[model samples]
Target: MRPILSALLLVVAAGAVAQPVAPGQRLDGIAAVVGEQVVLYSEVDALVQQTTQGREAPPDLWSRALDRLVDQRIVIARARQDTTLNVTDDIVSQRVDQQVAQLAAQVGGEPQLVQAYGRSIDEIKVSVREDVRDELLLQQYQGRRMREVKVTPGEVRDWFDRIPESERPEVPELVRVAHIVKIPASDEAGEARVRAFAETLRDSILAEQATIEDLANRYSDDPGNTNRDGTQNGGLYTTLRLTDLEPRFQAAAAAAEPGDISPVFETPFGYHVLRVNSRDGNRISFNHILLQVEVGEDEAEAARETLSVLRDSIQAGTPFEAIARRHSEEPQSAARGGYVSVPQTRQRDLSAEGLGPQWRATIDTLEVGEISEPAPVTLADAEGTQAFHIVLLQKRTPAHPLSVTDDYALLSQYALQEKQNEVLQEWVDDLRETVYVDIRAEQYQPPAGG
Candidate 1:
């Protein structure tokens, strides 16, 4: 029984059918009463304007919306009967705040948000929170309803057969790739020197001798934390999730409380010390300074020589996966037999963009199952730090029609959703009979019929 849903029940049937009138011209009246909830004509007019943004709508829009509102009220009432489903006001408030923060960022921050939205930050939050709560409740009900639905292969095939042959999907060229990557690290002496510098900065911040930001400006090698003024941030990052952070960073963040400094830690990006500014739920906002170890020409040459030996071994007899596991510096792919994979569910095509000029050229020349000549490439790693790696290409595919052999997962997902939608529709229909739904019959009349 949200205010927005209750208000839209009463539009003049004749005027709406002929064409839309300006908002001021609409008369308010009750369209239906559901249990204790009432629907109003002006609300319908406002909703049509809100939904279509004042564009022309079909004459029966108000009636159709009224029917939908009645159905929604039924589902909502049913959800209320099941006492275990609980969404708190604070959770709704947080969601609304997060949404507003995102909008504020898009419009050049909060001052501009007021300009674009014609409302203050607090005003917008107050208005949207109830609507957000309603959405969350509906989502919870539907999510619980569909949780155990699992579609089978036979069902997927049946779904595909129903589509016309001319309308079945064609797939893009898909490629499977494997690689070996190596990064240069300074000799032990150079690494020790960098680690010592990071330790010194941590001590300095602790003693209040100098700020983490000042130290970052002088020494942090990461390219991602630069300000608009071209000065480096002391790695001040906000709204970060610990799980999304690198293991070393996550551990450091978790071990410290707000206003406490984390012990120095090592990540591929560099050695670092973090100062926690705030913690909210599972997210943290923090400042830190990194001191990256600089590897010299000797280190780079040693890395290249090592990769050359690895390439020669793969050609001679050794399996690529075994050699990559022993030596590949690209941590993620190295563990997975050197394979470069798209998220199996997200994409089927791996476009050739940004693989570096060397990788792009090597991939283009290779046939399926052919290995590329060992090549030098620079990789921008997860922390936005750069390292040089030697690479290999393993497989490529040409464009082809989608089939059970190549696209089972995608087809199964589509069939599953269709089944879920049908189940949800039936659930809604069942709810209609049990609820006290009063659609005002006299309000919607047929034109003089033959």
Candidate 2:
């Protein structure tokens, strides 16, 4: 049975739900019937396009799409009957605004977004509001389902005891790890060069050596306002508070008197030089340029050396968890004493898989309670942020059957999951019986009683 609590609804697009038919294009039709609601072929097509991106369609993709739509319709229909799932327009508007902001960031600016989508921001909102409403309804229903689920200790132990020893599954070998992470400091020389660049831009604007429009167009990485004629409106930020600007940029702008160029300042995005054009109370209008810098390797070796010293302290009997909580930069595992969870998580099933191949090889040789020397690993993000980690392998466990003695805690969790899944399945089966689901497509139809 499919998971009933999953939130996998399609994110609606900026245009009409159905795509406009091109010349010689085939007309779309209804794909399924879910009670009073008709599932459109176009709706399924949009979702399939979103998930698959530009890739070739997977086998039974249509069936999977139909199944999701049916599940959503079932949940939504039931939700409308319940008075507890009330969601106001304001709440959905906030969600819409956040989604739009994300899209703006993704595309760089509002003007570029409008050009790309061929729709104004208001038009995009009207298209997405229906989707947001249905999603919020389903969220409330899932919350109610979770609140009604209860598990007891006796239920956990009884479930574990009934599983035959020979038939129990073997878990993969696993390691628990804690880590301290640090990024190298930005290069001082490069930073100075950037500051100088910002100052030059600021000086040019101040002396009227170059117009704000010219300097902003030539130098600023900040997205400039665009006109229909495709000309930028330049570095001017109208009606913004000093606080609205980034801290480093704000401080510089606040210090400078109106009509003077502020001292160049640095921010994560780049170096900035602000010229306050006017001030009214706390709000100000200003123009600025951003000069991006690159800094990943600077001071990296120093950070590694610091972590190595920390590991030595742990080796000398300092409690790993306490040290991690106090000093470790990897927040998730440090709070739990540096333990990285293994996949074999049931009672007696403590295991980890696919640590970097090199890390795994070394971890295989270490026993429980032993610590592996800091192995160097580089992590880079989508924004080109690069950092190094000094990892501590805190604990190791072998694959084994359910153990009443060592794995009681894990067994309790395992039992709880099993109980929840079983309860949720029964709920879904009941929902299916109440719904008027008709799968018109042959391959997409559900089996009887399924």
Best-fitting candidate, measured by TM-score?
A: 2
Task: Assess candidate 1 and give its lDDT.
Answer: 0.66
Candidate 1 C-alpha lDDT tens digits along 357-425: 666776888776666655566564555544445455554556668777777876887788788777776
TM-score of 2: 0.54
- RMSD of candidate 1 to the true fold? 15.3
What tens-digit string does per-residue lDDT give for candidate 2 at 1-450? 001122422211211144333233345667778777677665565456555655777766656766666666776677766787778889989987887777666555676456545579888778777677766777787657856776687887788778887776665665666566656677888878878877778777778888766777777777554545877767777756443354445556656788777677665577777778887644578877667776645477776677778779888988877777877665555666655554234222234555555556656666666665555544422333445555565556676665756566777776766776677656766888998888776643322111
Q: Residue 188 CA error for candidate 1 (Å)?
A: 1.7
The residue-level lDDT of candidate 2 at 167 comes to 78
Question: Best candidate per lDDT, number?
Answer: 1
TM-scores for every predicted model: 0.46, 0.54
Cα lDDT computed for each candidate against the true fold = 0.66, 0.63
Off by over 4 Å in 1: 1-174, 183-186, 203-209, 228-234, 239-247, 254-263, 278-283, 317-337, 343-349, 354-358, 361-370, 376-450
Residue pairs in clash, model 1 = 7-43, 8-43, 8-44, 9-40, 10-40, 10-41
Runs with alpha carbons beyond 4 Å of true place in candidate 2: 1-28, 35-38, 42-65, 106-118, 152-167, 184-299, 302-350, 358-374, 378-386, 392-394, 402-405, 408-414, 432-438, 443-450
